[model samples]
Target: MTLHVHSMLIDGNEVAASDGAVVEVDDPSTGQVIATTPRATPADLERALAASARGWETWRETTAWERSAVLRRAAVLLDERTEEIAVVLTREQGKPLAEARAELQSTVEQLDWFADEARRVYGRTVASRHPDQRMQVLRQPIGPVAAFTPWNFPVLLASRKVAPALAAGCSVILKPAEEAPGAALAMATALTEAGLPPGVLNVVTGDPAQISERLIASPVIRKVSLTGSVPVGKHVLQLAAQGVKNVSMELGGHAPVLVFGDADPELAGRMCAAGKFRNAGQVCIAATRFYVQEAIEEAFVASFTAATRALSVGSGLVDGTDVGPLASSRGLARTVELVEDAVTQGATVQTGGHRLDDGPGYFYAPTVLSGVPETATIMQTEPFGPLAPIATFSTFEDALRRANGTPYGLAGYVFSEDLTTATRAAEQLEVGIVGVNSVAVSGAQVPFGGIKESGIGAENGTEGLDAYLYSKSVVTGLRRLR
Candidate 1:
């Protein structure tokens, strides 16, 4: 299929880079260049920042009802164009068509949720100690925001930042991953068509380093939000610190799944396998380390390996393909390296261990490793791929200790029939979000983020809206006994 070149969305207009340079986007499913997007130059970034400043002025003054109306309309437009954008997402990010569509649907839901949230950003009238004093607290937009999103779940991640910022009346300049620029552009188009004023939302793609440094350094950007690797998040945080700008980050995760003996091993194995290999296991919250209770470890490993082997790995566009290729060659190499490292450190590959050489794409078979030692590299590192490593723990304390050993505190999961066991695991797991007998921990209504090295602050729910807002306290002297 022929794909069209995408242009950068700046100041409500689709334009090429000032230097006319472009970056080619590769289809990970086929290892082919499917399309190109304009590479944003330094000058283009300036334009976006200037436009954002102007947009912020107008947007912040807009009534909450008006902002809500625009977001609701944008959500409708996004819903209408779901299939078209989902195809683009599948092509660029190499996820199954169904998963791509689901991501877009989530994006639509986020917009809808934020639309209603816009009107609900309530302030409070404070009780005053003196009869003559009147006090109130108000929340105001924190000016323009600089948002950076990763290629995996590009559209959904972008919306997670943009929707909340917009709902809070903050202008946004979104720097979407160049690997999947079309989805963000499509979102920008929908918002613009839904009457978002020029400059309120801008989409730029190109050199990530250049764009981030310039945007974060600029005076126009009041907040910075990012969904990326830990290293990248740290870099962005450092840059934001120079200006003391408000920042939020959702970084990498090495989530652990604790399967207690009381739980149904077969059910837990099947569910964890499905969660582990979704999007070829590119998920930040993908279940990586499995600490199954010693009594059920053998059964869990057997079931998990069977489920992992059953996944159909192929091009995302093909029918019945459950797992797609890694998003890029680098991702494939990293996955390979992690597997090799684990094997060298005394892990046994129970199912898959090598790349799928059937085609030219960056594909790897869904792998399950048994007897993975804590000393193995995979135990400490976040293997953001379709690889599951299982180990056994004799006691609940041992499970908790091993699970909490990683520097990452993004997410953790537990499967136990006993409420006491599940609740204890939930309370003890050193992560921001915990899932009991399930891996579904993210949604528009909940706060999604991590602790420790995973990230700072939160996304979604009312907390997400608060990220883009600043509070102001007002006090007035009232006439006594008037």
Candidate 2:
């Protein structure tokens, strides 16, 4: 099913920009202009915010069960069209079809999880010191929210924030990435078909900086959420600070994977390869850095090199392709520069580093390099592509220090059979999330966020719902004063 790209969803209507400007959206797999979305202006922003603000009153009064029902129906619709949505995602985002399908499934699960949690949102009651004098704490919706989503994992990331906010009785104005607007439009269409109240969940698509800043600065939006780079997150934070608005950010990551001497060499190699190549390494939590114990460094490198070399790079539309193109021309150029600079800095190329010249897509080979020094630019920056840089460490402390050296503290992984060593490493790693003997560890029931420069706030499980809500204290007094 071909879906028309929508530019705006204001007052429960799918409408185009009044100015009629458009943005070209290409399929990264083939570099074909697949669609165009309305490029909204400040006027469209105002219409959405006003609509959502007015809708908040009714949405906040709506029953949690009603909201859950809408979400549940939306989930069903997503499942029914999973393949259609996944194709659009793979074509636009350059993720392998299998991974795209998995993301679609995950998005469905998130909607269901948040839908259930919406009903379970309960307040607390406090006992009073005197008879007839009681204290109570209640959770209330924060009003209209401005949600900004990134191009990577477009559907899943947006669902992560939008689903929870709507579930918690809040009206949302979504500004999805212009590169992949189909998935968001599909989601909005589902929500509308599921009988969601008009204006409760309006969507607006356009340039992020121009649209997000204006929305954040407006008093009509009481909260803001984003999933993007550290620099963008900070900018959004600064803008949100003007209103002291609540914000949840899931930003950049330079995730490290430590392979200790005790780790099973084959398992470590396989897991690392899978994590690094997933989404062609566009994932925020992809295992980009590998710090192996000196004794087992050769063995780990050999296995990892073989695994990465065996990957099949091609268009995501094809079956059996392990890796796909970068999301756009800019992503391909950035990855090329990082690899070229790293090699110039004396890093040894292990297996793959060349762009695939066979196709129109912006494809790059899964790359593995060794002997990358601490000062290499790629060492600190997230390649966000199919490049894995490996380094050796003589001691556990050295590996820990190097892993924690970056400003990002999002996610880390350690492969060790020794429980004591794993525990120590997990404790010392400053990241908010750590993977022991594994590479992938994100779920709907866990609080997911980063520390330090990674960004602020958390999402998922109970905390995600709490992010879109506020707490109020109530006190009761007797006829006589205390």
Best by TM-score: 1
Model 1 alpha-carbon miss at residue 351, Å: 0.7
In terms of lDDT, the poorest run of 10 residues in model 1 is: 1-10
Give the winner by lDDT: 1
Stretches > 4 Å off in candidate 2: 1-5, 480-482
TM-score of each model, in listed order: 0.99, 0.97
- In candidate 1 the C-alpha lDDT for residue 183 amounts to 91
lDDT of 1 at 133: 94
